[model samples]
Target: MTALFDVILPVFLVVGFGYLVCWRKWLTEVAVDGVMRFAQNFALPVLLFSAIARLDLGANYNPLLLLAFYCGAILSFLLGVALARYWLKRPIEDAIAIGFVCLFSNSLLLGVPITERAYGAEALVGNFTIISIHSPLLYTFGITAMEFARAQGQNLPLGRVALRALSGVLHTPLVIGILCGFAMNLMGLAGLVMPDGFWAAVTMMSSAALPAALFGLGGILYRYRPEGEMRAIALCCFGSLLLHPAVTFGLGKLFALSIAEMRSAVVTAAMPPGVNAYLFAALYGVAKRVSASAVLVATGLSILTVWFWLGALP
Candidate 1:
């Protein structure tokens, strides 16, 4: 279908290219690590700041739509936790990881680019707003879940853990970028002009971020496979591909969104599991197996899911 060609095919191309590079040893773990570090540290921050700084905070933004999106994410996360705990009977740590995989989508790298392609630049403001809120949830609640799992046999300083988690959220580059953008917007000082040369340089660097992040993701996926964790991975893929998007579509109607806003919300909900889920899992010593599996399954499944959603869009 035309939708498959336009929206889904491009994602596969990027991911497939990375897979080939990794398979051929063109990108090693070291190279992937370096690229990821660069993305997290520099390129992503620049992209976020630039996008948010230019956005008009006073514009006709729909707060209710944003609220609905967050509610959907929270419910999805809870559902994932319940399924993992009761149905799968997974260990506490693994359940937490599974819940995160089901809920925490790659909204920054994959979501932004895909939504822009589907809905255009105006939708980015809403998309970024969602990311800003969602990032903290992924970092804090996700980490706490893992900690709870890890501390099952031992004791943990719950108060200290909460404070540390909050600190981590405050210090994250993405959070910092969002804060700076908000401050700039609030002060109405983002209108300060930059030289053409400066603008060109930032544009060049910002452009490289998306492709590099995608390629890094592809390489990571190439290096890892779900292997024996197929069942857990399948559940996550289904949640991301089917359940989350369906809920988002239903909620969008309740919000009385315009066609474009509804499309943006649906596409965002359909995004694959986020790279951050893996990072948090690894950091917290939780279900590393499921985390790795999630990356592989989510990336592969997104091709079909995105195609279907785009096709059904009016």
Candidate 2:
């Protein structure tokens, strides 16, 4: 309990501060959006690039751990799609957007900080390992599914659809950051070829990513109210908070992951849907309400669920 509070509450408090600022109108909506733009477009990409550039692939890229975490994530995405599309009767496009909310966890904002606080900074290699491919992989999967669904209605050729989807995924800032990092890592001799000043500048930008993201997320949440979509919201919360982590936990056990690996995978899997969920929905102009509400509600629910997972993880 104390440990959980110590690890989790501070992070929420930053989010709450952002919320309070927005609610009180202390900051203009434009200002909030500007902050978010900076965070998502600039700071976060730099952060990812820096982290991945520095990551030791051989030391941290555990195949089993990746399998456990990502399998759970993909499973949650599939289940979310089924629930939203079939049970909830959302349109296929809307279902894919909602499923993306389940697919993309708050890995950087919530997962990294919470894991660092709970376990220690040394345990973050696994978290970074997962994060390295997370956005690129999931966004590719989501975009391909979404584009093919749209193509069915538009009578577009499969080649064009595939090309369009690939174009969309490659154009995203996060994916660009990951690709650049991989390029640097592979070609630059694991980032050793970079000058100290270059890394220093990257570090400077990286420092602003999380706080700006959280604050901007709070401001965005202020705009999205939970009007209808109650069932969908509940489904999203269930998929993100409970289902994802449970799958990861089971897989970690089956894989015989170490305590640190289990902790990183399960804790990260337990995070709420990130602000990117809303962004993704907004990008497609589908299920924006459900995705935003899921990000807000699941984040609130995670305060307890995360504690439960913390206790439950061995």
Candidate 3:
């Protein structure tokens, strides 16, 4: 109850507020899109850049932790694809979009803040470690898979398909921001090159990333009805809320990860599908309904699911 009220409810309150405002017609769809655009293209990217720039890669980049967490993520993706393709009778492209939804957890907006609230700021190093490469790695994998799925049966050369996919991934603002952060970190130019004022301004913008995105997500979600994808949405919710974290928890135990690492990995894995899931679906024009409904339903379900996981965790 404490976790439900203290940790999860506060987050949903913001989402609910957005939904209420949109329901009352106070915020138009275009306005919501503008907010999302600001968050996705600018503020969130700045947040990622700042987080990765100052990330202590040497101390927190635990290979075992990453291995445990990502193994679960990949398994969920594969399961989502398989179940959607075989059981749900969705097309290959739709299956891939569903898989992407299951694969891409809300690591940033939900995971980081939830972990911070549940544990503490001091415990966020593991969350940060996972997040540092979360977008880049998952986006790459999802895009590559999607491209390959789209390329099936076409005479398009494999190299061209690969290049096209690569181009799409590279052109994303989030990916660009992550790459820039990595370059800065690797080249040791974080503090040395950028002026303090620049960093401060980044700090200011980055702070709005989560709240604004969450609010925008609520409004955007209002546009997507669950409709005919009940089974698919249930599968997505199951994979994201239960299967992913179960795999992560088992792997973490096998790896003997510390309490903090286990907490971070499982909690992150338990988050609902992010807005990117719907964005990916919308971008590819496949399974948009399922993706969006899953985002909405899973996010609502996560209010309870995350509370359970928090109790189940050490």
What TM-score would every model get versus the actual structure?
Answer: 0.90, 0.95, 0.95
lDDT of 2 by residue, 284-314 (tens): 8999888888888899889999999999987
Q: Which pairs of residues collide in model 1?
A: none
Candidate 2 overall Cα lDDT vs. reference? 0.89
The better-scoring model by lDDT among 1 and 3 is 3
Q: Residue 263 of model 3: what lDDT?
A: 95
Question: Where is the poorest 10-residue window by lDDT in model 1?
Answer: 184-193
RMSD of each: 2.4, 1.6, 1.6
Which tens-of-lDDT digit does each residue in 1-314 have in candidate 1?
76677766786688688778888998688988888778877788778777776676656367876766666666677777788888888877767777888788788888888877776777676777667667766677777666666666677778866777788888888878777766756655635665779658778878888888887777778867766567777888877777888888888888887777677677888888877777777876767778788778888878888888777666
Superposed Cα RMSD, model 2:
1.6
TM-score of 1: 0.90
lDDT of 3 at 164: 79
Ranking by lDDT: 2, 3, 1
Regions more than 4 Å wrong, model 3? 189-193
